[model samples]
Target: MISALNRLVDLVEDHLVEEVDVDGLAKALGTTEYHLRRMFSSLAGMPLSEYVRRRRMTLAAADVVRGGDDLLGIAVRHGYGSAEAFGRAFRAVHGAGPGDVRRDGGPLLAQPRLRFRLTVEGSTPMRTRLVDRPAFRLVGHAARVPLVHRGVNPHIQRHIAGLPPEEHVRLKALGDAEPAGLLQVCDDVDPDAREGSELTYLHGVAVSGDTPTPGDLDAIEAPEGTWAVFRTDGPYPDALQSTWAATATEWFPSNPWRLRPGPSVVAVLDRADDFGTATCELWLPVEPA
Candidate 1:
């Protein structure tokens, strides 16, 4: 996985001003583009697209300072059709317009080339199980919420809080599948898992495929797939969030499974009344790497 990511970085550098064939490269590397993008974002702390933009602007700054090319030429050379488009991208990355930076020879934000390395740390073991599940439907209230990498997402909190207490009981009554209780379902997540990106958040319950969904509820169709379920318990969300991160950093890197495109579900098995601590089962869709 580390080697594949390094190759990806090389590919980006080799095609800074051109289109990057991530799908092609991922196929050649025997991994799906989805998994590649997810892993890259998880470890790099930025989306691959964001990295490309920063790198492009980093190099463009040199040209802007050198004054060897006109703004239009520089823009064209960096894959933008016009100066305006390039300026927007440039300002987004470097926090200064190309024209201003060129005149003052000033502030430039550079995205350093990335390299992946492995560390030998296996002091703690991950508790996981592999399950082959059949198709099911998640039904309940759904909302589009921004992705938050850590802590409780207030948007989700508000969504749940706004629901009538009876709604929770009603949703739990609809459960008839492995994730048994009311589940926290996150779907249509960005493969890159960019923070603040909008994703479909379903506060729902899972039911067998044949189970009839309530007309009043939103439903998400989940196809049959292999799942890697991890069990976590500790302080509120800190432990759960850490386990999620470790799946990318520790588990996937060592295991033969890779994440596939599907909704990630969190089942709270046990919890304190105040929600200060809890045990959770994190269900992630996966396939053999």
Candidate 2:
């Protein structure tokens, strides 16, 4: 996996001004583009697309300072049709317009090339299990919310808080399946898993496919698949978030599995009344690579 990611970085460097066939690359490397993109974002601390844009603009800055090629020529070479489009990308990455930089030969922000490595520390051992389950249904209240990586998502907090206290009891009574409790589900996420991207957040519980549907709830149909369930316990979301990040960083790198497309569900087995701390189960869908 580390080698594949290194090859991906090499591919980006080799084609900064051209289109990268990420799907083909993933296929060749025995992984899915979805997993590849998510892992890249996790380990590199930025989306792969963002990395490409920065690298392209980084090289373009040199040309802008050199002042030989026309702006249109430079733009076209970088795959932008017009100077305006290229300028927008340049300014986004470097925080200065191409014209300004070209004129003054100043204010350049360079994105250094990234290298990813594994660090093994003997710390808290993760409690995890791999489960194979049949298709199921997740039903209850659902809302669209922006993704927040590091902290508790207030949007989700408010959404769950808005539900009547009895609704939680009602949902629990309706559940009769694996993942046997109320579930926090995030679905229809951007493949890149970019922070602030909108995703379908379902505050629901798992039910068997044959369970009768209620009239007043949203339903997400999950296809049968394998799942990697990681159990966590620590201070609020900080511990959960760290384990989530580590899955991409250490677990996936050391395992023979890759994430498949499905909603990521969190089942809060136990929690403090004030919501400051909890022991939770984070379930991610996966398949043998």
Candidate 3:
């Protein structure tokens, strides 16, 4: 996995002036584009697209400073059709437009080339299990929420808090399958997993496919697949969030499984009365790599 990610970085560098054929590169590397992009985003802390833009602008800055080519020519070479488009990308990355930088030869933010490496750090073992589930249904109140990488997501908190206490009991009672509790379901997520991207957040329960979904709830069909379940316990969401990060940085790289498209489910097995701590089971869909 580390080698594959390095190869992806190399591919990006070799095609900074052109469109990256991520799908083809992923196929050649024996992985899917979705898994590749997701892993890259998780480990690199930025989306693949964002990295490409920064790298492109990093090089484009040099040309602007050198004054060897007009802004339009440099923009065209960097895959932008017009100067305006290139200016937007440049300003986004460098915090200064091309024209301003060319005139003053001033501030420039350079994005260093990325290289992925693996380190040996397995002191604490992760408690995990693999489950093969048949088709199931996730039914509950659903909302579109922006993705937040770290800390508590107030939007999700507000969503859940808005519900009456009985609704939580009702959702738990509705669950009749594995991941057997009120589940935090994040579906239709962007493969890049970019921050601020909207995703379908379902505060619901899992039920067998044959089960009838209540008309009042939204339903998401979960196709038959295998899940990599990690059990976590500690401070509220911190432990759960760390386990999620570890799955990308440690588990996937070491295991033979790759992530597949599906909703990520979080089942809170136990928690403190004040909700300050929890024991959670995080289920992520995967397939043999």
Judging by TM-score against the true structure, name the best candidate: 3
Stretches of candidate 3 off by over 4 Å are none
Q: Report the C-alpha lDDT of model 3 over 22-58, residue by residue, as the tens digit.
A: 9999999999999999999999999999999999999
Ranking by lDDT: 3, 1, 2
Give the winner by TM-score: 2 or 3: 3
Query: Which of the predicted structures, 1 or 3, would earn the higher TM-score when compared with the native?
Result: 3
Report clashes for each candidate as comma-separated counts. Answer: 0, 0, 0
Candidate 3 clash figure, as a count: 0
Cα lDDT tens digits for candidate 1, 27-122: 999999999999999999999999998999999999999997899999998899989999999999889999999899888888888999999876
Query: Which ten residues in a row are the worst by lDDT in model 3?
Result: 117-126
Write the residue-wise lDDT of candidate 2 on 193-289 in tens digits.
8889999999989999999989999999888999999999989899899999988887888889999999999998899998789999999999998
C-alpha local distance difference test of each model: 0.94, 0.91, 0.94
Question: Residue 234 error for model 2, in Å?
Answer: 1.0
Q: Give candidate 3's error at residue 249 in angstroms.
A: 0.6
The alpha-carbon RMSD values of the candidates against the true structure, listed in the order shown, are 1.1, 1.2, 0.9
Give every collision pair in model 1: none
**Which pairs clash inside model 2?**
none
